[model samples]
Target: MAAVELTVFQVILLFWSLRTAVSQVEMRCPSSCGNICIPYPFGMEEGSYLDERFKILCNSSSGVPKLTVDGTKLEVRDISVRRSTIGVMFPVVSANCGGKDRNTVVDLEGSPFVFSSENYFIARGCGNLALMNQNQSTIGVCVSICDKNRDSMMASCSGTDCCQTTIPSFLKVFNVTMKGLDDGKGSSGEKQCRYAYLVAQSWINYGSYYSDVGGDSDPYDMRHRDSVPVVLDWGIDERVFESLVKNGSFHNSSYSSTCQFLNPSINSTNQSSTVQCSCRPGFEGNPYRYGICEAGRAYDNYRRKIKAKMAGIGVGVGFGALFLLIGLWWLYKVFKRKRSEKLKKKYFKRNGGLLLQEQLSSGEVSVEKIKMFPSKELDKATDHYNVNRTLGQGGQGTVYKGMLADGKIVAVKKSKVIDEGNLRQFINEVVLLSQINHRNVVKLLGCCLETELPLLVYEFIPNGTLYQFLHDPNEEFPLTWEMRLRIAAEVAGALFYLHSAASLPIFHRDIKSTNILLDEKYRAKVADFGTSRSVSIDQTHVTTQVQGTFGYLDPEYFQSSQFTDKSDVYSFGVVLVELLTGQKAISFKRSEEQGRSLATYFIMAMESNCLFDILDPQVVKQGEREDVLMVASLARSCLRLNGKERPTMKEVTMVLERIKKSENLTVQQESEYDRKEVMGAPWDVTSASTISSFDIGAPSSLDEKPLLHTY
Candidate 1:
């Protein structure tokens, strides 16, 4: 009776699986156009269609299948099920070569498809201008110019013989037209055809489809004749998924399928919400079919065979052997646990955990101040160091967001290098940060040493870095002039404390806008002390390898390999310039004459009496002219080529503080006061006769010797 029941159950299971597979096949569209498979949701036959937009018409009158979208007769080259895009060929218009001027217009209005952002409007020909218009409004124009006598060299659409520009995203329709220059004249008296169309970046960049020249050798000639692949993004309303789920539809029927919401355009509405579906992670099959999320067939069959053998063994005197094997496994686990613990202790010692304990015990360092967390605790907190928990990355190492057992959020810094030198620095950071107490500095909570690389835990900063606030377009709130001034003052104060008021004189070698973080209140928090050096009271400066960001590095220290308090001041001066201009430390978009550093451009502007030209408009409007000039002048003195001419961090902090307080002071009075107090002050760098008061201008001093820029 038992054997009969088991057989009956097995038969039922087999029947159910077979029934599900057959139903899935029937629901899915198995039709094809030549070699291209028309999957479900996209159908070539009326019975296989799920909607009118998905209907693909196939013409086979010529004995070759050609697919058209929605009976529009536009040939479909290929379809992408994963990316939710289709490649179609569009007509291209040309001039000068006398090709028929068929101005191509791709009209996709009221359709589920839009022009993908991955395509570019490109025009290939000299002495021609390509104009792209949308909704009868001119959107962009690209002109290519070439000398008649010069040899033509094809470039990658960089405004040379071929000119290209990016099209707007979410564009539903566009018209491409070309105009010939100088009465339809061609380059070098040879008729050149101008081709303009929207083409996929991948296809154009591949460069494998160019036509054979046959000694004619026009680079713009296309091998595929009048057709080029154009990519279109397709999406449908999210309600489709809900309907499928509620009605038990086969479309996206797999259990391991997920839906993604598309980025809606400004004109998107509830009736036209866009969504897409794809197979979930670790599953690869047709998402529109039942049982689509199953693992590979080979693995499933192997597992079944192994299970059958195990069942037979269990029914025939294998219980005793199984019990013995379980006992051995338990012993092996215990041995492995002990070995792991031993290795953890070894790593702890190697990472200076023992030395830290010794220092605490001897009263050389405070006791029970910095916690030493176990490796397992940190690993669990960070979910085995998942990439999703990553807060940010830098040249030093990666930082991950972690939650402690006590429900406290923290930042876990994982250093990349484990060299002897870096190990010492890591230990030093622990020691210094444990004793250091400052509200504007990031707090060191604890550390974990069991891992190959040491991990440092710091108090989590809620807001992003100042760089994001200054440059990121998506930042909800703009950095106002008042806020920038306050932030500048706060960072200057922090640096002042580090340079003069800390337990030891610490020099922050790297000080830029990026290194400065903002907290919940938008207050500045100076961070990243990996390259900081501590100096003794008797020592004037430290001579070591120069290390800092390219645009912010102090030119004097960069050329001398000698770092001092003034070096940090120079970097901070660059930060001051950043705050003033709202520009990056190194900007590639600026004109070639400006050089890479904003400091150089700012200095030029100040020298040329065009300070307002480069000042942030916000700063100009909110700040008084005299105040803006004062701050600009202060930044200029800080950025002086001579280290001695730069004001100290203390002076910078005082000036920013005074500027913030003197907002109500009249311009006349302010100018008079500046002339009286700051006339002979070291901050004055306008005239060449200003003398250095800090003895930094002498060549014999290491503080004045310029360093080489090379590492």
Candidate 2:
């Protein structure tokens, strides 16, 4: 009788699976266009897609069916419902050998599609420099150098006759322009036609697709096949679903029943709002269509098999089920612990633990100086990164105040989500900071990589940043003229050491007042080395993506994307201006005529002979007039639009030191003169004359030949 009841239950389960499958089949809509599967959110027919923008068109006029986006010639190659991506054939922008250069513009401004970062901006042809622009700004650039040998020219896309760079995420409009370098020469000694386009990154891994050509051959041979596969990310805004529900297009219940909404994440690159959706787990088919997503066939088969097996052994298993469950639970706990440890190891490896270990072994990074803290220790110290312990947050990560097991206080920097491409930079910060042993630079205590996000441990700085002290003054600890001057000297000394005194020349690319942390003594300690880069002794500058605070960024570096030691000088110059004026680097509180840039405002004030008008009240009141003018002049020289004209950090450091020494001498003279009067001793005429002459000559000497003149 028990066996008969088990068989009945199995039959009922099979019936339910069949009913579910039949219902899915009945609800299925037109699901294909050409060979591409038209998922519900994207369809080739009316009432099948989520909206009009999701519509696709099928054309079979040429004896071969092709799927295209509605009202556009762009052909759809593949659709990924799960990843919310689509592969499309995009035209390659070609520049003819001698004809006017051609540029390709793909506008998806109002659509739900964005050029995925997985696509590479590829440029083919020797002596070609390709630029991908958005809103008239160069976002991506690659240069292909000429290779004399024809065989070597077509070998790879490693900047020899071909080059590629990753595109930015959330890129809706792609504009590619290719320019010839050195008269567009190629291996054949003629202007070769260049091809530039956005292609799916995976497609390039398949191998070389371009054919070698002779000198006399037509440069437009690849014109016959004009398009390359490009990947595009697609997503619908959550507001669209809310609008649909309000307009009675779909019931609120149908939303989650068909499609699962993903957790919204802020895309810092574009600041655009887009929400992704996919079919619920265990279901397959059109997620945007109600009742269309059903249990996968494989899942249904597995269920059927499980029911059959259970029917055969149900009575025997029931007698020992409780003991088996308890035993299984114990095994699961052990398995889970092992899995957790394995996952931590995986994260550590992924975060470049092996590379760091190699550096340590190779003596590139001193092993004795840096430690690798356990994730659990940091977690406990920061109270599991509680909000109350949060020190500060920035574009790269958040800093939390924490205490170690040894009763030592530290700052824990928890980085934001980092992709594989940026892992090198993350490890780079570790290596760079480990090599640095300067007193004015924040010390790297260690790092913990056995967590989801890498954590950097740094020496805690009690006093906040120079920016806060300058802009938001604390009555208890006012940034007096002496303190500001001392802080300036300390920061300049640190930068000079980085530029000329370090084992390897390091560039603090993101130098700003905010990055300048103050210690308990109000001395400057340059912090935040995440964006710093070290270069070889012979290298003058590093050509890279433009990065820095807007107003503090070197104009020359911004225009050319070449960061030099002088670029740091330019940023430091802005900090100097901030110290003098006590104004934000980029502020709208000033007049439009000043252009809202503190550097520009300061320069204008100096040029107009109104330097004291915009000077910080504290600086003007306590600072010596000659010394203030001298420092102002030094700052102006550093802020020169031309990088070459700016004084080197070493030069700036010397000028500051000279100014400080002169102030010290003046203070000593006044102290000695007061002591003589207090004791009623006979004043030495030579000493009084010496003091008078020194005071009289100092300002004139500084004005006639500025201290920065040596640079």
**Tens digit of per-residue lDDT, candidate 2, span 1-711:** 444467667777776777587567645646665556677677666877777778777775532224334245677878787688888888778877455455657677657777887988878776888888877778789888786675642435677777878887677777887777873432342357777878787766644433332331323233445677889888775678667667655444542235445432323343346666555665565454432354565566666777788667765677457567557767887999899899999999988888778877896544466688999899999988976698888988999999989999999999987888888888889989888889999999899999989999999999889988987799887889988888889999999999989888999999999999998888899989888999989888898998888999988888778888888998999999899889999999999897699988887776566778889999999998767766776787688775655667877787787678777466444222232221233323222221222232332212222212122
Q: What's the CA RMSD for each of the models?
A: 19.0, 24.1
Each model's lDDT comes to 0.71, 0.74
TM-score for predicted model 1 compared with the true structure:
0.57
Using all chains and alpha carbons, the TM-scores for the candidates as numbered come to 0.57, 0.49
What C-alpha lDDT does candidate 2 achieve relative to the native structure?
0.74
Clashes of 2: 0
